[model samples]
Target: MRHAHKRCEDDGNWFVHPVTNKAWSNYTTCVDKDDLNFRHKINKLYISGYSVSVIALTISLAIFCYFRSLKCTRITIHKNLFISFIINNVLWIVWYTTVIRYPAVLFSNKPACQILHVLVHYFLLSNYMWMFCEGLYLHTLLVRAFVAEDKTMKWFYILGWGCPTVVIITYASVRSSYPEETILTPDSHQTRKAVRATLILIPLLGLHYIIIPFRPEPGSPEEVVYEPISAAAASFQGLCVSLLFCYFNGEVVALLKKKWNQVFTSWKN
Candidate 1:
């Protein structure tokens, strides 16, 4: 009998697993095998909306950052948030346009694949880390009632750009120790989900609830009036809670179900 799993010779085609011999299709390709016009339309709408929002946000941030006169200790946190938002927007565009649209390019060559993998993963992780930094800085200013006498621009560079760069370098070093192809299989997807939960999501949530609120000193009346840390804290808390639910209840549960199904199928066969 012919092998159940077969690898496609062409990178553009689907690949079959050696163990299960199951053919896996590339969903990233725009080719529509199924008739899902409504779904496709919705996706298009989402992409367009996201692109417009990103562009608007990027331009607004750029304008703000360009005006050095607007720089101040309090505004430094906003600047960091702007930088993070810009990077996140760029990453989103690249991810959707390149990885999602033309995934075959990812597996074209080892160097190309590695570069793409690093850029995609690094930017994505950095985006979240910078967001956490933004929250942390705001919390420090507001709740802890800490004020930096140093230049705001320098502080912005350190927290906004420096921290994310450090995180990216650290994550890249760890990932490079065990490099793999760009393909995202079901198993690899699960692993990525777990890693994100443990590394990014959990820590962020912890910072939002446990760390930021229970800092050295609660906000003074002046700090509360000027900084609005409580408002920011509430927003962070809501975001973290949403992410926790999505990962644990939604994504994790779905991945587990798929894994169990695969195991059951193998046993039956």
Candidate 2:
């Protein structure tokens, strides 16, 4: 949904808030009663979705760790990706509960809140970078079957972790130079659908960018229909990835079934 701004007065001045008696940007259209109720529902949905994702990702990580026989370069990359997703999901949950819910914290410009903001985005970038590592590894494996896995993993590690650190550090440095008043805070009425739209969709379609051209205009009726779907997809992305890559993996399933059969046999004896 698009934010509605108050029209300028005839004298080319901003309108005054009746209650504050000060010149302020009127944004009432963006946060009406119905929108608040919708935001409440979306908040609950995000918590529930992220909680499920955390559980799923944690289980996947455990599976990867416990199965020594399943260990490989690919599983290593998967483990790192799972860790990134887990941290990102937790950060989002914390963001919703603390920073997002409390306008005072944002207005106060607390260092902790700003740090959390950086950390949340750091892990988000890590998630995508690790995914890139996965693709690169697979391509190298196919094209140059004799390539040394151990040697390449070092480079992958740098790409996945080091690159994001460099980028974020540069970003934070540049951002900090800007004046405090120039910093834009998130509006309560503005959902993060666009920012998170590609989270799970990437796994389903490696080219999630295809949908970018079709994005509905902000504040259009189409946006009302799109926001919930985008949010839900982004929130549950970790769960979807864990399910597709870990729980449903052929080797993992076979190993688990074999373990169950052995346990059943021992119990029978």
Candidate 3:
């Protein structure tokens, strides 16, 4: 497919191939020949469902945040989970509506695209980091129930704000080594490597789950009872697992199917 901003003429109004010096008409055909009907229907379904979910989650978080009394309870770790959920949903909404819809802008405008790209990556990393923190906090409460009530506010701030910042800084540092000309090509092997790395890194959530449950605590009535930490750990673990299934595994399978179909069609033609 031709680039959206392909230079045409020296005067800069025409579509010209830089390599071939071939001038093309201003009017270009759509890259995908599929009818807009199915695409539009899919887009509507995605936007409506995602928007509703994000709104509901955000409202729930706001209500919880406003009630400071509720935040003091052992169950407040769930509030952290709620906050993480809201942030992630917001990221998804922005990603789909802005970034995904403007692929050309992302590729053509380097500075703006890089900023958006970094922000997107930062939040995506933050979502998982916060989930890992949630699991850690939950496990701590389960094993050390009394301590869960002590210094809850301090730990809450640390986990919610501190961890994401650290992760973002680390990512930015690593990304800084690469040149600005690093464009992701369609057949890039680095894509697979990055995916593999992410998958390996995300499972570190389970380590938090394991560590929290190992902390020492006195055997008391509160200790015997299921703590909020355990619940949060379980909830976050379940979420991580489900997301892996739906987002990674399912999406990969669908992508493979689409690629295979395209290959078969090309061979037939």
Winning candidate number (TM-score) = 2
Residue range 1-269, candidate 2, lDDT tens digits: 75867768999988876544678875666676766777677787888899999999999999889989988877898898899889989999998899777766766666788788788878888888988887676556444545777788889889888899998888778767873741023333322421232343355524534554677886578876676766677788888889978887778999999989999999999
State, as a TM-score between 0 and 1, how close model 3 is to the true structure.
0.51
Which one wins on lDDT?
Answer: 2
Error of 3 at 142 (Å): 2.4
TM for candidate 1 is: 0.48
- Better lDDT candidate (1, 2): 2
Task: Give the Cα lDDT of each candidate.
Answer: 0.50, 0.77, 0.53
Ranked candidates, highest TM-score first: 2, 3, 1
* TM-score of each predicted structure versus truth: 0.48, 0.78, 0.51
Model 1, runs deviating above 4 Å: 1-32, 35-46, 66-69, 149-156, 181-269
Clashes of 3: 5
- Per-residue lDDT tens digits of candidate 1, residues 16-125? 74434567654435534342453344345435544554565555455445556546543454445545545555555565566555645654535655666666666555
TM-score of 2: 0.78
Candidate 3 residue lDDT tens string, 1-269: 64444445577676764434567544345544343443444444445555565565555555446545444433365456555655555655575677657655544546666666667666555656555555555445434434534566577667666777787777767776774443013133634543553454456355555646564464344533333444345334434433443235443446556768998999999
Report the Cα lDDT for candidate 1.
0.50
